[model samples]
Target: MYVLKHGIKRNPEKRWALPDRIFFGYGACAILAGAFLEHPSLEGFYGERIIPGEGFSGNHIYATNGVIAFDYHGYSAREQLLEHHKRGWASRNPGWHCTIATVDFDLLDTVELNRRKMLGPDQYLHDPVPRARRFLRRIDHAEGAARALRTVTRSQPMLRVACTSDPT
Candidate 1:
């Protein structure tokens, strides 16, 4: 689950699914920022292998937002996005604060688990692993990440204090 905070909104439906495709959108940077700033272990998750060339010529722009191991283009794109985001945010809001995290999930698997639970208690009680999985399950991974962001902010009391205090 990777929450995004940007200057513009692209998707009108807002209920986006996994493997969502957005043409000429800045969503890639949000994914990359999460991988870079927090989950270095899951950088590959941030990089999207598919590219849609028909709509936007800037399809190549997101190549760098992934890990080099998964896709070199994405790795480079991620670097560019990170630098650009930091610089841009700094210019606009000198005291800009942010934290990023992506909670990778298998949507189909989650749905299946939920279905099993709904069918019978025996299905869920059969395994402790299912309980763990259910605990982590989220209706929307990005929204889950947004919840995590709140948890993060709440846990860091110092961060709250620092945010309010004058830098000088």
Candidate 2:
């Protein structure tokens, strides 16, 4: 209270705008920031997400049902949970899956399909830089799926050489 009186700070704006208007304005800007923050985690948290029509993205847990040109489409997180067929289970058999029960929550089917297919969506190879790649780079530094793809492409030749028993 003393600082408010004595400090050289500027006086606050005292216009009589409706509180609701301020609330709505802040709310809208927050939503927009979440929607297009470039980071998947940030964007997902801020915006309503839906899977694009092409289908599941290997890296993005929040794919929308329809595609927008860019910064135009949106979807809810619930849609992503449903379409992926994500499930909850341990590695009861071989080295197969990521044990999605921890992540899938309750909405999706959790079908025990091919593990690789689950980690990577159908359109994963179509572009040099996929949306999921950017999303991954923005979210987690450790297990970004896009980075994982690059590793695979770079190491494929080395792996084959090792498998073929090359001298060096």
Candidate 3:
């Protein structure tokens, strides 16, 4: 506590000093300020590969907050969805130490190949009449992806259908 020293035997050198608690508060504030000033590491992070004009899987896989992530796109119209490994995955993800890594990129590459195959021999490139086989292939594939992903997520009860006849 500090008070006006009017008629007390006080030295003139250290007469006007802040309280001890106030000095300590300033010290703590300085330390917190330094911690946040440091930047996060972005040196070895791998770039994501996604192309435009490619096909969409249309299956929602993950969700966070109010955002939902559907199936990943295989190809892009502008550039390749996945590029060649100029550098290894080790360089990209330094702490990526997985013992049971079983995914093969070769199988994943089939997405673009399958899409083209479903469209048939490109017989009528100019003539847009009767492209039923190709049309059916894409439709069936999209439906299958949706159905498979739906198995993982449990749906909420129908809120608007409460008035329906079937109560079961």
Candidate 4:
């Protein structure tokens, strides 16, 4: 029975920033999804995720472009994403059943914007557009790093094979 906390206030003049792990969950998903919409291939969804047997439920906003789904967990195949959640939760709670119902992206975005306006001027929460952009940049940078690592690792086996095959 998770619920959104409202009326949290912050100093209007103070500079506010999102935590490093902001991509992990909650409203941050919404912001990230919104930002991801900039990519024409992606569509954002507001998902109401619930595990009825375990009495656990939450909202998980994410972006998917037919083939890939992206969220706090990063990129996954569109088909495997929800299944992955189910497996993870089921492991913790025997007989766990999870389901996600999607709502319109616009509706969720509007609601989030309204809620932020109600909350005082905490720059991190008050204005999501720029925050989302910054978050997207971080994601891109991380993806680049991961790709580079994978490339290096893949070449290692080849390098070892070449060294072993050579005779002095």
Best by TM-score: 4
Report the error of model 3 at residue 48, Å. Answer: 18
- Model 2: per-residue lDDT, tens digit, 1-168? 001233211222221121322311211212222233344432223222222223332122332212111121222223223222222111222322321111222112123212322211222122212332443334443334344344445643422110111122
TM-score, one value per model:
0.26, 0.18, 0.15, 0.50
Per-residue lDDT of candidate 4, residues 79-149 (tens digit): 45555565555566666664444424342355554553322113343565566566666666346335534
**Which has the higher TM-score value, candidate number 1 or candidate number 2?**
1
lDDT per residue (tens digit) for residues 1-168 in model 1: 123444233443342321322311233322332223333333234422222223321121122222221121222223333344444554555555433222232222435324422112122213323332332232244453344445445544322211121122
Model 4 superposed RMSD (Cα) = 13.5
Better of 2 and 3 by TM-score: 2
Per-model RMSD to reference = 17.0, 20.3, 30.9, 13.5
Candidate lDDT values, in order: 0.30, 0.25, 0.22, 0.45
Please identify model 3 stretches exceeding 4 Å from their true place. Answer: 1-100, 104-139, 155-168
| Candidate 3 lDDT over residue span 51-117, tens digit each | 1122321111111111111112211111111111111222443432222111122211235324423
Error of 3 at 145 (Å): 1.4
Model 4 lDDT on a 0 to 1 scale: 0.45
Give the TM-score comparing model 4 with the true structure, all chains together.
Answer: 0.50
**Residue 145 lDDT, candidate 4, scale 0-100:** 35
